[model samples]
Target: MARQHPEEPTLVELTIEEVKAMGKQGIDHPSTRPVITGGVVGAIAGAVLPVVTWPVGLFAGAAIALYTRVKR
Candidate 1:
């Protein structure tokens, strides 16, 4: 017959606020300022640019938003 060993318990170090704040930066962080700026710029550009360029600007703005969020 074999004897089994007991397992040690692990401790988690995160606080409630820190845990709540985790992964929350993507939309509301300061780093996302560029994304907001990009969106506004894209809107203005879309209004003035050709119909084809309007979509391009919007996509570019979305790219900027993703870039900022990923970089952060």
Candidate 2:
């Protein structure tokens, strides 16, 4: 079995810390840009698609981006 690094944080811990940082820092947080980019891309996709609304697409995109960022 592979041993985990003592200094490395677990996924849950990293996610919690990232969430806290986002809440405290708002747009200034490091994860902001990727999230915003994802939102924009989603918005554009939504606009292009007749079934989905821009607002919903924007939210979904941002959430996906945030998840990816946290995992990283």
Candidate 3:
């Protein structure tokens, strides 16, 4: 009979602390600051785009927030 060893963990099981051991970090995420600025640029774009109605601007900004959150 062959001796058996314990099973190793999967990638998904690794925790943040374990990942830090690799030292694979960046200013934002291994590349630089957050790709999504999520600031005045988005705000201004959303506010200026929605022309269906005055309220559309607010809806646009809200939609941006919703989409980004979901994507994350």
- Most accurate candidate by TM-score: 2
Error of 2 at 65 (Å): 0.4
Q: What order do candidates take by TM-score, descending?
A: 2, 1, 3
Greater TM-score among 2 and 3 belongs to: 2
The CA lDDT at 27 in model 3 is 43
Model 1 Cα lDDT, one tens digit per residue, 1-72: 889988643222222233244348755755455656776778678879776476678767855664555444
Q: Least lDDT summed over 10 consecutive residues: which range in candidate 1? A: 10-19
What is the lDDT ranking, best to worst? 2, 1, 3
lDDT scores of the candidates, listed in order? 0.58, 0.89, 0.44
RMSD to the hidden true structure, all candidates: 10.2, 3.7, 9.3
- Runs of candidate 2 with Cα error greater than 4 angstroms are 1-16
For model 2, where is the 10-residue window of minimal lDDT?
Answer: 4-13
Candidate 3 clashing pairs? none
In model 1, state the lDDT of residue 63: 58
Per-residue lDDT, model 3, residue 45, is 66
Report residue 10 deviation for candidate 1 (angstroms). Answer: 30
1-72 in candidate 2: lDDT tens per residue? 999867888888887888798889998999988889999999988889999999989988988898899876
